[model samples]
Target: MSPQGHPWQKQPDWRILDTQFGSGNTFLATWLTWLEDADHPRLLHYVAVCQQPCSASELIKHFEAHPKLASLALELSHHWFGLLPGFHRFLLEQGQVVLTLCVGEPLPMLRAQQFEADAIELTLPHTCQDELSWFLKAIAHCCRRGTRLVMRHADAAETPGWPRVLTQCGFTLEPMKSDGDDSYRQKPSSFSGYFDPAWTLQRTRPTTKTGPLPVLRCAVIGAGLAGAAVATSLARRGWQVTVLDQAETPAAGASGLPVGLVLPHVSSDDCTLSRLSRAGVRMMLQQVSELLNVNRDWAPSGVFERQIGGTPKLPLTWSSEGTQWSANGHPDGDVALGSGLWHPKGAWIKPAALVKAWLNQPGITFLGNAAVTDVRRQGPTWVLSNNSSEMLCEAECVVFANANGAFELLQKMKHSALDTQAQESHLPSKQGMLGLLSWALHAEPEEARFAPFPVNGAGSIVSCVPTENGLTWFMGSSYQPDAQLERSDQENHLRNLEHLKELLPSLAQKLAPVFEAGTLHAWKGTRCITADRLPVVGPLDATDQPSLWICAGMGSRGLSFSVLCAELLVARMGAEPWPIEAKLARSLEALRA
Candidate 1:
């Protein structure tokens, strides 16, 4: 496909869907071509489907013939893991190139996509020809007018009625354009066509009719992890993001935690939360690797989980990939005294560092001390005002990432400038406060007997976290539903020591004296949580089009879920390929209650 002269090439973004992906040569070629073109689309999204994906080594070998492309393939191989059954997103070439690899039956996978493709490529196996009509119909759902389609077959005689089937579908056949490699005409057969249906095609999923936004401007109402992540994602997509925070500095809310654990949740049936956590952990780790300093701001030292009463129960169909993420473990006395589960990819991250990094991205503007109290839709744009009714700013859209503050803002909208339909809409939680208490103690270099990595079960203990004073060990995070309720620091410290005693008895014994002496420091924060415990992301109301959105309810997993939820929100707004499956994406929707 030529990057120039095509109508889509002039657009801001171009999407391609491939029915059959064998060895991933086509994707590599397309990515290389996009790199070579100076006037290429701002974003290139390539979606490919395959039943069995090749290993990283196999990919490297496949590109050996093309030496120039081999280096790019090697770079792609770094993120070539965890190809399970559903969608996997890889942000390549500094986030300009997005690859969504769907591992399943091609036809069913095509049906799952939400956006219309600008181009389509087919190289179906012989077995799929029997269901060719159904496959073509599925392809039609993701096609728009003038969408280019190229089909490669073994020979013209092998598929005699293919031209008739193309007409029956929405495509109009055209002569194949020959490049300098004319030798291909003597061997295999290829047909080129464009989607020019005589009748209108009914699409089940919502498609973007207005294309990219004329003005990519957004205002995020929190400067914590969630709001910072939303700002960063939109900024990377060329949006002018203005991040406003109530505090004097970013991450002065729940995201101000010293350190937090990032691990996948496990369940017997692999519930929705479990799957979503896995997706979140993957995205979080990738971001931490890219933006933060390893070992200082974050560490991939893995987590040792103590399965209090019993062993961890994973899904019965757990694959090797699942084991790689989490598996049964029998550790020596140093890590944990008893048997439990081990997460090789689990990490401990300082949330504030990540938030600061996201807010410092190129296209983002951070404005602190701008606590928005009133939000009203004015014409096509949304306006924000402070508690004193002083105007903060106006934008094409507004996202409430201010945890429990979102509920109050939405409540204000119900009686303010919101439309009649929006006024009657249900607002987010009013009881959004969840208090968490954790304590830390300074440790001398010689006296640090804590575990090498983090240990979690009833609670978590992270040791050797670098602080300005020296090395510190953090432990015990007691949960309370009401943030306003009175609770003493000593009481929370004692509660944390109780969990430390269960998680690491020897270490707990070594540090008990500090707790008794009242030398341990207490850190308390209030997290916003929904009743179901999943994050709320997407539109704020059920109108035909929504201008106000919310990304909150991150709870304790903000370090893990913030980036994933942010990307999911931007994906829905731009109609780009989703970061997770549509079902999982919907589970975190803003107004899903």
Candidate 2:
């Protein structure tokens, strides 16, 4: 698309859909163009579909001749790993430029996405000619009126019927000047068009536009991971966000955990939760890279998980991309080697740091100790009140992200449509406070035997995190449901020691003396977990004009799921493309049956 005639020239954000990402040259060029433009759109989203994506070296090699684009290509290559068959979102230019790589078959991948493309660049390999009609039909499903389309092929004579296919797909072709130079690429034959159908076009769901959805007042209850994430996501979209919390400081809840593992959950079937965790970890890592202090607040040092009886197994669909994300066995040079999985993309993040960073974003105001006890609709605004019926804040939108507190608040809103659904779904019985106990030692029992990275399985151990008492090694985090809760610190330490023994027998023996001495520091927190084990996300009240939302029930995967769920929530509100696939997003729906 030329600058003069670009449809998204004056729009808040522009979205383009690329059918195949052969070398990523088009994406690089588009990004460069956006960067050079003095008045570029607020956001530039380039969604591309790839089948069996190349390695980072291969991607970087393609730009060897294009000196101007080489640095951009290198930046893109760094986050190009884990290109499994799913939607992989890359946040470039500090989240301004979004590159969503849909890795799979073109038609199926296009169906999985839900954004309205401002421009379309179609270039299919010769092998895809048979499915060209189907591909165009799927592409049309994501187009809006006046959506510009361009088709390029090596030889137009080979595919004379493509024009007919475009017509059937509801794309009206535009006349092109002979031998016109395509700004992005100059192919032998090129056809330009816009989406304009004659008859009523049917679709499973409406396409969503990239957004700067009218900035309004938004009150996010809970200054923890979920709330802070939502606040940041909304604030980035220009919303005035007020983060209200019961505690005196941000992340003064379960999110107050000093350090937590951000790793993917592996299952044989690559179940919904597993897929969701992978997406979440990817998003969380990107956020950490942009917002937190690496090696201090967080570290992408990787995690080794011992499977105890059996070796850690990846899903049957695991491929090279899976290896980049997680391997079946640990890497070399590990003191605590065993039959476990190595998650190279895994990390340990101090949730409070991330929460603080998110809350500190522009347009976001953090108000602690607000303790929103009741929520109700007043005309078009959502009114949040405290325990004494005193108003906390009134905003155009409200999101409950206080974990178990969300259920209690929702229960108080008797007339809420979502409240009825929550009650019928047995949300209370489906959720509970799960107390966890972790202990840290001022010194390592055996420094030489300590693994450099975190190890998890029966329980978890993170060695050598800086604390007020100096360097410390954290372990255990013994899981104790409310019923089996132990109030004594010694009992918790014993339980944590038991977990260490199960996870690493040899190391446990060395640390047994420390546990016996009761000199280890204890850290305790209660996490909210749901029966299905997935976080609740999406609109809680009216779906048509939703004003109330809930993003909670993160369990122990708060670091893994918070950013993803926050993006999903704000994406729905702004009508932007969902970060994950529609089916995967549905699993975390707040009002699911």
- Top candidate by lDDT: 2
**How does residue 172 of candidate 1 score in lDDT?**
91
The digit string of per-residue lDDT tens for model 2 on 1-593 reads 33544566667788899987878867887888888776778788889988878789998887787777889999888787887889988878867788888989887899988778889888855544558777788888889888887776635566557777778889898766534334434353356789999987676766652233456999999889999999988887778999999888999888988888999998888889988999989988989998988888888889999887774578877888788888877769454566788999989888999998888888999888898987777777878888898998999888889988887777767654345445435442445655555656555344435678888997798887776666677886867676564558887788888988877888888888888898777777778887788888887654566777789999989999998999889878877777899999978877775
User: Model 2 segments beyond 4 Å from truth?
Assistant: 1-5, 125-130, 177-189, 204-213, 333-336, 415-429, 444-448, 483-486
What's the TM-score of each model vs. the native? 0.92, 0.93
Q: What is the total number of backbone clashes in candidate 1? A: 1
Per-prediction tally of clashes: 1, 0
Q: lDDT, candidate 1, residue 78?
A: 75
Error of 1 at 294 (Å): 1.6
Cand. 1 TM to true fold: 0.92
lDDT of 1 by residue, 1-593 (tens): 55556555667888899877777767887787788788788888898988888888998987786776798889888777667777777778657788888888887787778778889877645543458777788788888899988776535465555667768887897767544332312223267888999987776666532133444679999999999999988987888999999899999988999999999998888898988888788778878888899989999998988878774677789887678778787444444456678888899999999998888888999998998987776777777888787889989888889988887666655434555345325444535454445556454444647778888897899888998877777886877777467577777788888888888888788878887877677777888888788888887655545667788888888987997898788877787777787778878866665
lDDT of 1: 0.78
RMSD in Å for model 1:
3.0
